[model samples]
Target: DFQTWQLAMYCRKAKLKLTMKSILEEYKCGKVRLVTMLEESDDPVVKTVKPSIKTGRKWKVAEAIDEAKECLRLKEVIGQTQTDRKGLGSSSVKWWSKTEGKEKRDMVIEEVRQREDVRRIQKAVQQPQQGQWTNWDSAMQRSLTWKDIWQMAPLRIRFLIRSVYDLLPSNANLVRWGKKDDPTCPLCHGRQTTEHVLSSCKVALSQGRYTWRHNRVLQELASVISTAKGQSNPPSPSFTIFTTEGGARKWCWRSNTASNQRKGLLDGCDDWEVSADLPEWDEHPEVIRRTTLKPDIVIHSPSTQQVIMVELTVPYESRMEQAHTYKKEKYLDLT
Candidate 1:
């Protein structure tokens, strides 16, 4: 019920093979390992044998073998298998009995094959994998795959993610493996680790790399939104996203406006409504306020005297909720 008992299975298989070999050795026979024979036939070890004639003729056929032969003769070459490798895992159920008469060997092979197959299936069905719960395992689950990770990230970024997950060659890992000098953070000169470099380094955060990357993504998105807003007929539901044939997917909307109009396949977006006359979106456009608080981006609809504000936060995965809370508190007055 817990696991496939590999050791027990191997032992049982070994016992069965030993018994089978002893029984067949009395008759000079062996079970061929089919896969091994095919894969390593050129090896100098595998041997082959052919069956010889024992009978000469049938009573009804007098002239059938007047010279020497009568019965159906097949020049079948049977592989002479090694008894040293005989096990329950043997690929061949058939045996080379070194006899022209195959009846006894065939019957033995058929019975053994059928019996072993049923036993193997029953054992397989009864085995299951079980593991003890660990404190380090994640409670929050997200179904992410390699495709999702690799799709938009650069090769360096992909390698970085792999290294992060595998804990490969980082100072912390090197130290764990007892092969390290200094494990100090490159930027902050603190105890260097995967966590420090990715999230906890004050020097890195102070350098504003997080904000810079966040802004770059937003800027590209904003540009695309602005361009899409200008297209005729607005956007509709059930829109399919298509990228330019020869460029990055992010640059999909950068094609000529005239060509987009001709195709009329792409839509402005799912969550956004865009029109030249509806409203205006401005980036950090001097929000007149009692306090110095300003949104990263703003949507101004003059007719309704309303402003929809936006704030972008690019925090480490562990700090998303904290970042969200801070942003919400910072913009409470606007809301």
Candidate 2:
């Protein structure tokens, strides 16, 4: 049956049975003949249908119609011309025929699809053994439709789709399938989850696999900041200083302006220097300080005496807010 085929398609996609209702609720196509029930008083066919049917059950259309007419009363009423006695199509209907309604329906469908994608992503993240993607954008998943998936090689399509749904033959999944006795990671001696092999292994981290990617991102950001407008060399310090006997020192900035007002942050700074923690490249930025804490990127303005530190993190979406908060607090004193 068509319904069975539809259900099978959803199952193939790893979707739940709840989607069956949505598939069956779309507009039905058949020989149109209706004028007995109107679900809403403001429905498009309200003016064309008989007043008795329109006013019969205004409060709760479905329940009232079910109780009164049983299987006879249609849920959605259709407009019919007096002479032809045929139901009017959507193009001829009033409120339902508006272009805004079509646009709004498309927007709602896209929003629902995005939410479903996010739900699937969160489910994958929560899978302890097979979890891999925790920071994927729902928009990217939503953009890949069945048409695109079908175009990929069959083996690739199966592998890619199975990976997303945690159905791949990973160690943990093999254990779940009764094919393996243990799911321990060979290198780290921890549960061999998909994420562990790809990103979270201590041995891999120690070998600088993750750091390589982190530094690559930092290098690009540092390059952008270095070439940004208003980034120039700072002028030489021009000030008068006095040291008291107790070793306390005081300094006054000497400016050409007669206003005697102080300049704001970055007000007179033309040169800004950019630095990053990456040291693998020949033209790598210089280390600004030999402190214990080193940020991913740093932008310093000598003239303004201001410094901006940037810390980059690639955390899971579920822990993104926590990571951001911790980073901000860690750098609060420096700021």
Best by lDDT: 2
- Candidate 2 matches the true fold with a TM-score of 0.47
Alpha-carbon shift of residue 60 in model 2 (angstroms) = 15
lDDT of 1 by residue, 256-280 (tens): 4434555432333223332211124
Kindly provide the TM-score of model 1 when superposed on the true structure, using C-alpha atoms. 0.39
Worst 10 residues of 2 by lDDT: 24-33
lDDT values, one for every candidate: 0.43, 0.51
What would the per-residue lDDT of candidate 2 be over residues 278-334, giving only the tens digit for each residue? 775232234346555677777776666667777997654345567778888876766
The global Cα lDDT (0 to 1) of model 1 is 0.43
Q: CA lDDT of 304 in candidate 2?
A: 63
Q: What is candidate 2's CA lDDT for residue 249?
A: 75
- Top TM-score hit: 2
